[model samples]
Target: MSALANAPFYVTTSGGYLLVLAIILPAVAVLAMLLVPPRHVARIAFAVMAAGLAVALVIVAELVGTGMALAYVVGGWQPPLGLALRADGLSAAMLAMTAVVICATGLFARFHQCLEPETQDGRAATTFWPLLMAIWSALNAIFVGEDLFTLYVALELLTFAAVPLVCLDGRAETIAAALRYLMFALLGSLLYLLGAALLYGVFGALDIHSLSRLDGGAPAVTVALGLMIAGLLAKAALFPLHLWLPPAHAGAPAAASAVLSALVIKAPVFLILRLVLDVAPSSAGPLAGQIFIGQILIGQILAVLGASSILFCSVMAFRQQRLKLMIAYSTVAQIGYLFIVFPLAAGTETLPAWGTIAWTGGALQLVSHALAKAAMFMAAGAVAEAFGHDRISDLGGFGRILPISALAFGLAGLSLMGLPPSGGFIAKCLLLTAAVTGGHPWLAATILAGGLLAGGYVFRIVDRALATPAVELVARRPIPRRLEAVALVLALAAVGVGFVPLQPFGFLQLGRPAVSAMVAP
Candidate 1:
């Protein structure tokens, strides 16, 4: 029997099985599609995306309704020996975020997601759905896995699935980019796996809770934590470790680019958070590894990197001649926001410590960015589709030709820029307040600076699109009403999250650690 089975919410707690099903169902859908001839691949992929999205919605609704953690036991076995999946507030939030983005990406890909749209049956097109499904599955596995080894497997699965999505077009440059991604990802995986091995050897456990229960006495704990964090940082594409991301993400098909940019790098980040806050003992994390290296200290470092990424990449984003490359740089900048919570929430003296405010902020940032970025990328895809190129300057008067896409892009841009009544604005505001309360001036500065830089980049697009051009853009094909509407809805959703109150919310607190658990009075 599952540990959570006795909880009043177990009937709805299938969040765990729902997680696994979310991951595997798409893979199964892909396999079934493979059996069909080429012409049917797009139809099959769309059908699967439709159903997969519904499953995601069910899980989200249950999470919202129960206001509790959800779980599922694989093989009816519990943790340590039996694999399990669990979703807390943060995880459920992420799941819902991923579902929305993936759904948009699928619709956007229909414009040219296939390998050869004209060929009734072709290799690239058919391979697209399978790869997309694989990526989604890998993402779900990463989110809900309760054990270190399980999460590591999920990480690798995500990497493998994502690498192929980069090179779907079979171009030599894209192939090379994918290979670079594969290699760097492998190095990161090795580091993380090594740490997991060390921890298992020392504690005889891979479950996060069990590992947390171990006395922080072993040298193995320190070394393992270091290795694991370093690995996740690489995959997260943080600062110097981000060598592969720009090319790989930019070169992928637009639909793939949206997913890669919006979601793929996030799995490792979630794992890193788990390793620090869940596995590390409260008294074991310090700068030198003396106490539970409070996630806040590392959070500061993350904030600095985030700030630098925001400032530096915004400039890089501005310089990009290709629309997708610019958006890719914007992605790197947005990711910086996710890392700011560490320093802002590191106080060990308070119940819930500094975790709650920063955690909720980071989750909101992730969700908002996913929705906004996906919409923007899809809009960019629409631009490229209409004009046959993504050169920002050459995108003259695209707003006139593709009004809906331009409108969607602008709304998404509004959220990314942290404008009022948008999720991005609320997320940043919360992080800023947390920084101020926590006395983290550097994090506070980064948050403000990032918003400014984001505004600059967003305005650049809006300005260009709104310009009365010497010549106006014309669509290569009729822009579909359904696709346009979906993109618009997603952009609006990012704005909707802003409606959530600015205070530290109880919803975010629901399953978080109690006041006294991590923070000693």
Candidate 2:
């Protein structure tokens, strides 16, 4: 690694202000929404989305142009005392993915609301704009925040914003689901905060850059990381801690479900990645013996949990009769792939974890899942909107009625099922290859089994779409082509990811050398 990669301090780059714009633009729009008339809220939201997307693109461009992480020290103050925002290649990918999904979701929600013009300026419609923008702001903040405490605050904002979205329809069941989500999420927040406090007390700093430079053998460090990972697992809805997800995701309106499933849960997962890779001590120096054992233990435990989630929730998804609930369960199943990366990407003395093929596979899975799952939810929403319900058995001949939605659903399923010409296939292949080469046959088996299970669940819906019912299915209301088109575009994007080379992507590795240098030395 170069000297620049070994630098522990952050330097404010020329384009660092773009990160601030990314976080604040949606927030400013959120405040603007509160002062505007109900009729103008959506307009403001649309404008913000456009600008936010542009900012995210610019951030990505600057990152590629400079070939370094963009960093901005707040108020010209350094970390361990003040705050900083940084965006690497991974962060830029996340920002761009978020912008695309949020934009697609906004269009979907706007069209869905237009189905009932009387409700266009109604409470639910108006309330959605501010909450959506708030989520955008929180997600952006989480992506760039350089400290653990800042991430915790961003998580709180995300939780508070996301909970209400679950109950936006104001149904008793939806409200109950929202409350369940809130309770579990709050418990997660408490655990995460406790861990952050412990870290700060031990090292006198909470910034990732500062902590990555410290020794990792202290008992407090281990316990703090354990607590934080456990807390993040709950928030991520990884299996066993995942009881709140299905109902909360399935019960929410389609746009809300898309955002929650595709974007919100990912924040905690991102933090976990940082914790394991950047903050965890490398297995070197005098304490190498102790730290190596600890790292392996954590990786194995998480891999087992991930395998269990993939097998168990996939089975549950196959059994669900409701369209949204099945997709919701699939979300949990898909999340397993990310956790399994911990073990698959375990570093050697010479190569860092992020340099492995498994790391690229995991990143691909995250981005592809975000795009594919959002399209699936939007397609399901369109189905429910066209018909009065989403019961798969009764949805026979649906393809004949809403061909666009049916096509979108099927295309998204291609990714979930790990089929060819889709991002999911390439991701799973990389992961499977890593598992085999890394001498983890069981994980390789689990990867194959998970793909099979995913196919079973996906084909159920596809079969229904191709079925000939005794009574022909009919649309309860006409769905706009534009609404369906948004989902198709997202699904296509998911598919487009397959075109990338099947290797550790250079783009994803752009800003990782610094962290790798710190962790592996």
Candidate 3:
């Protein structure tokens, strides 16, 4: 159920067509790949990617210019029967960011997947184009979908598309990793379905806005919310359930890793946030110290899980000997920062959660991590491609061979370590401020501790890059400068995000349910 479920549905708005184009254009490109020869697949894919990027930008501009969410109801029918697609400020922002990362990954992959002289028309290259488009389509669908069941369908599409990308190389280990990912995803899907069914059975509606009108203290509603969130946590790979992540992400090609880390996992998290704050009753007058679910305060629970994720996974990231594995682990650690927003953004008597500094910080963290992690993965991919390995110990003086790639890595690291003039710095600082003001000393300490640990791991790689190795490293093949530029651009975006005003972002608050509207009489 959505927080905006009860709001009036507008059939089509001024910029509504852009949302349709954003979704269908990539899907059309995927179809085009099937008809064209393998050689032209990359061209069509790139063209679609470019158009998709434009559409996403237009959607953002429309939201900003109009200062209202763009909405499209199918065939003049509203939800509970017809599906609706709506893009709020947060959705628009995610759409733009997804387009940028996907485009960058497409460019980087072209060089990374340079056709073999004998196998220039290989299936591997052709398959990647369709898969990429499918992922782009699925991600857009999830962001804009206005109903719970529709989101479930989008999640399934995302999973199916993402699994193939994981094992594109068809190696034994990668195949195993992909299977593991699929298994966990299937379990998550089932749990989510069961929860959705429960919600429909209890409330007679699966629309988020519709669900928000229900009595939050009901037993069925509480159980359904719990089941739904638990399922999403599994999909999000939060801490204890993250076993399938490192292998699947690290085993994928660098381009795939960027998508998986940057966008795929975040979708589940976004849904969880919606479920907690929007669909679940927030003004239910604390039922036995818990309003989120019958027995548990979802915000505090999520914050504790977030803190545990940060402390445990940061150590795991520090101990990884391989570069890609370390980056994958870091992704897990960074996601924890997002969950911490739960407690920090849980509004007091005077303010709304969506208007809180912690909410803005969390959103910034999500976008910045996507940019930084994508850059780091691409840079590491280039290094692995050049040196034939990614062992950190053996990477001594490796920076001399690929200075641009190393520079990209360093810039991304700065964001990860929360250094000034980088998005991570501003995001973490805001979260820290909220924690201190909220009187949550432990969470404040977690923020600092995570940043310090991040610096330690980042320093390990920087040290290796600058040191002299006994055996000089050599490139197995030449890497194009354009490939290097792709990574640098994303890293620069991560840094540039820091320039945003250091306060609660008004843009993100657009389309949020009005406080008066959220409370049941």
Candidate 4:
């Protein structure tokens, strides 16, 4: 029975079609948007968003019910010769989370677009809907792509879809920012492609599962891993490579900002995680232990970079005079916490990284931050729309004018600050526990310091929201209550993630190689 179960199956499952549907639905919507009359575009986009959300939710339900990763062997051909689309626990979670954020962002954008009827067929409005769908499709592809080559294609698709959103307003500065983003992204892509080529040449397979079974400690393999990881870090905007993120995110429209901050950057980070955890080899022999040690060393190096990002970017966030720029900087800072999980999740000789508490913490942080940051961006957008400018100093008592938006911003800030009864708090606490237990005191210190710095920046916004301005500020136009509600709902979801059991998440471990199974005889 064990052998039978282990045998390769070239057939598709009942749920396999869902994966195809998830990727193609948005692409179809993009095509429809181009063909349909301009006036009907928003309606079609919303319809697609609703359908996409349902598909994502169904995928999650199917995974939870079956307790297995969903895989579709395209055209009944398996790896090495054909592409496969697979979603493990992490991918499914990210899929659902991405769908939720994209749906909310679409709703927000719809209202904003409607506010200016003249711009319905304008470049920003018509272009945004299709691009949004394109982004959704590319993100889905990245999550499900089982082959390195397929992922490279998905990354390119994502970049093309996202770069234009940055300059949707078509301003000179924004266009310049978009160009900077494109150039850096292309450079990262080239590096990643080179690394992929190296791996393919060495292993004769581009599939992750196949690569995982190979002897992974070869110098060539190490070099390829280094190149791939560095390229992904640049795309993820981690620390020193984060130069393109702030301007691109801040200058984009609010909906675009939410999508970029909440989703786009995560693709490369997800790839990094996959490369480190799935493709790397671990076994019981002395040589295997050395391989494990090398991987751990890499994890430690990443943790240090994560710490620096938290410290440096948090200070930058606190210093920003504009609300959107401050939030953009905060994104870079919050992303650090995700990387800090490297050392914590780098389990000892007796354990697997997937089984570590830090793994769950990291996943939770990713999902919670996506929700919270999306909410925060939308709220900040609302504030900017009402007041005409996002200058923090000039927007005193603006919360009184936009009470719901203020509430949304505060709720999102709760997660960012890692306050109690919030998902960010739970995630940080788990990571902190792992750090202390692992005897990594510096990592523990970094966690606390990051939280403190987050508090400072969050307080800056909250203080301005409540304070009375010396010169009263008037809203140029009133923000719709429903728009503020969308942000608040997302923020509440971020807080709600705290309620999950604090133990190592069993769901995230599902479909991953078992620690016991991997043990050598």
Local accuracy by lDDT, each model: 0.76, 0.91, 0.86, 0.88
Ordered by lDDT, highest first, the candidates read 2, 4, 3, 1
Over the stretch 1-521, how does candidate 2's per-residue lDDT look in tens digits? 12224554788899999999999999999999989889999999999999999999999989889998899999988777889999988899999999999999999999999999999999999999999999999999999999999999999999999999999999999999999999999999999999999998887888887786666446788889899999999999999999999999999999999999999999999999999888885224467778777877888888999999999999999999999999999999999999999999998766778779999999999999999999999999999999989998899988888888889999899998889889998999999999999999999999999999999999899899988999988898899999999999999999988887553387788777644454443
**Lowest summed lDDT over 10 consecutive residues: which window, candidate 4?**
1-10
Deviation from native of the Cα of residue 242 in model 3, angstroms? 0.5
Please estimate how well model 4 matches the true structure, expressed as its whole-model Cα lDDT: 0.88
Clashing pairs in 3: 1-208, 2-208, 2-209, 5-209
| Top of the candidates by lDDT | 2
Error of 2 at 483 (Å): 0.8
Deviation from native of the Cα of residue 227 in model 1, angstroms:
1.5
TM-score of each: 0.91, 0.97, 0.95, 0.97
TM match of model 4 to true structure:
0.97
lDDT of 4 at 479: 84
The sequence of per-residue lDDT tens digits that candidate 4 reaches over residues 1-521 is: 12123456334667888999999999999999999888888888889999999999998889889988888999887777778888888998999999999999998998888778798678789899999999999999999888999999999999999999999999999999999999889989889999999998887788887776666437677778888988888899999999999999999999999999999999999999999988765222346767777677778878888999999999999999999999999999999999999988986546888888899999999999999999999999999999899999899999889999899999899999899889899989889999999899998998999999999999898998999888888999978898888899999999989877553287777668777767644
**Residue 476, model 1: Cα distance from true site in angstroms:** 3.9
Alpha-carbon RMSD, each predicted model? 3.6, 2.2, 2.3, 2.2
Per-residue lDDT tens digits for candidate 1, residues 1-521, read: 12233342222254556777787787787788768877777787878788778887887677778877777777776556777677776777777788778877777666554323564356776687778887888888887778899888889989988999999889999999999999989999999999999988886668765665555444677678878988888888877677788899888877788899889988888887777777765324332355544444455566777778777887788788888888888888888777766656564555453356777788788888888888888788777766778888887677887888889888988788888888888888888888888777877877787788778877788888888998666677776766677678888888888887644366555556576755432
When sorted by TM-score, best at the front, the candidate numbers are 2, 4, 3, 1
Model 1 Cα RMSD, Å? Answer: 3.6
